[model samples]
Target: MKNLTKKIRSKKLESKVDLTAMVSVSFLLIVFFMVTIDLAKPKGIGLGLPDKNPEWDGKIVCGMGMGDRLVTILLDDNNKLVSYQGLLSYPNEKPKTLSYDANGIRKELHNKKRLIQEYYGDTSRGPIVIIKPSKKCNYKNLIDILDEMAVAKIDTYSIINDFTPEESQLLAAN
Candidate 1:
C-alpha cells in the first residue's frame, strides 16, 4: 500500500554566505586607489626667501637700480591694501588703496610690469614687490596677497616684516 504517512524526511539547508567575492572586490578597490591616488604631495606657493649673506651690505642691492621697479604692498587691517610704485620716502607713484581683486592689485601689477618693460627695454625684468603686513593684518590677507603675486606672475617679491619709519607712519595713517 502507498505509505499513508509520507516517509519522514530530514532536510538540511545550508545557510552560510560566501564572502570571498566581496573581500576580493574590496581588496581590488583598495589596490586601485593606492595606484591611482597621489600620496602626500605637497601643494602650495613656492617662496624663495633671501639668505642673509655676510657679504650683503644694508642696501637695496640687485642687478640694477630697483627704485623704479619697486612696488611696495602694505597689508593693513579691514583688508585694506596700500600699494605704491618706488619707495615710500620718494614714491614714483603716490600711495593708493587697492583691493585684492583683478581690477585693483592685478591691474596695477600688469600696468607696472608693462611700464617697467617699456622703461627698461627688457621683457624679462618685472617689478620687485615688497609685501609688508601690518600688526593688525590677519594671516589670510597675507596669503591672499602672496597668491596674487603668483597669479600676477611676479618674479621678485620680499615679505619684509620690519617696516621702516615711513612705512609704519603710512600704515597708521591708512
Candidate 2:
C-alpha cells in the first residue's frame, strides 16, 4: 500500500537555450563580410585635365626659355618607349629607346626632373613633360606613361596628339 501511494517522479528537462554564443558568432560573421566588401572595391587614379577654352592674353607671360626644362616621352608599340629632353627639332638629349622598368623610363624621369630643378634652382618649378602616344601604341601604354608621370611627381605635363613630321620620323627610326 505504501509503494502504491508513492507517485512517479518525472525527470527535470532544460527548455531554456543560451543564445549568447550564437549572437556573438552572427556579429563576427557580419563584421568579416563588411570588411571583405570594403576591400573588394576598385581603386581609381586621379587625372586632372586642362580646360579647352583657356583665357590667354596673346602675350608671353615670362621670357624664361623652356629649352632646358622640357622632357618629351614618345610611346610606341611592343612596350617600347622613346624619351628625349628639350625640343624634338633641337633636342638637348637625343632620343633613346627605353623600357618601363625601374632602370629605364623611371630612372630617366627622376634624373631629368632633378637636373631641371637644379637648373632652375627652384623646387616648385619642375620639369615640363610632353607625352605623345603614337598610333601603334595602345591605351595601356598611354596609361603606363601617365602612371610614370605620377610616380615621378612631375608638376607640369601635356598630352598632345599632334606630332610634327620630325617627331613622327624620330619614333619610326627608333
Candidate 3:
C-alpha cells in the first residue's frame, strides 16, 4: 500500500528545447550570404566629353595613341555616321558612311570595343574615340551616337567641336 502511494505521487518531467543558438546562427548565415552577393549595375556609357569654356585655346591636342587605335566618328546633320580608324591624314582611304540603323553604328562600336578590350586588357590604355559633330548635325544625332557608345560599353570617348581642315575637306567630299 505504501509503495503504491509513493508511485502515484511521483510525476514525469517534460523536456525543454533552447532555440536561441539556432536563431543566432540563422541570422549570421543570412548576413554572410548578403555580404557575398553581387548586385546588378546599370548600363550606361561614361563619356569624357569636355565642357565648353569661354577662355579656350586652339590647339590640336591629341590623347595617347590617338592616331593608331583611334576610332573617329563624324556626325552630320542628316544623322549620317562617317567612321574610320587612324588619323584624318589617311588620304588613301575614305571613311565608311552608315546610317544610325541597328546594323550600322552599333555593330561598328561593338566590334571596336571588343578589339580594344582584347588587345589591351587595361581599359585605361585602350582605344580612344574622337566624335566630330558638324554644325549641320541635329541634337538628336548627338544623343543617338552617345547612346550607341553606351550600348557598345566603350570607356573612352570624346566630343570635339574643333574639326581639322583635312577632316572638314573629307567630310565635304563625302
- Per residue, candidate 1 scores C-alpha lDDT tens digits across 1-174 of 887788888999989999999999999999888866755466677433233345666443453256788899999889999999887777887899999899999899989989988987877777889999988899999999988889889889999888888988887887
Backbone-clash count (model 2) = 0
Please give the lDDT score for candidate 3: 0.74
lDDT of each: 0.83, 0.82, 0.74
lDDT of 3 at 72: 88
Better of 1 and 2 by lDDT: 1
Give the number of colliding residue pairs in candidate 1: 0
| Candidate 2 wrong stretches, greater than 4 Å | 1-64
TM-score for model 1? 0.62
Model 3, C-alpha of 111: deviation from truth (Å): 0.8
On the 0 to 100 scale, the lDDT of residue 147 in model 2 is: 90
Q: Which of candidates 1 and 3 reaches a greater lDDT?
A: 1
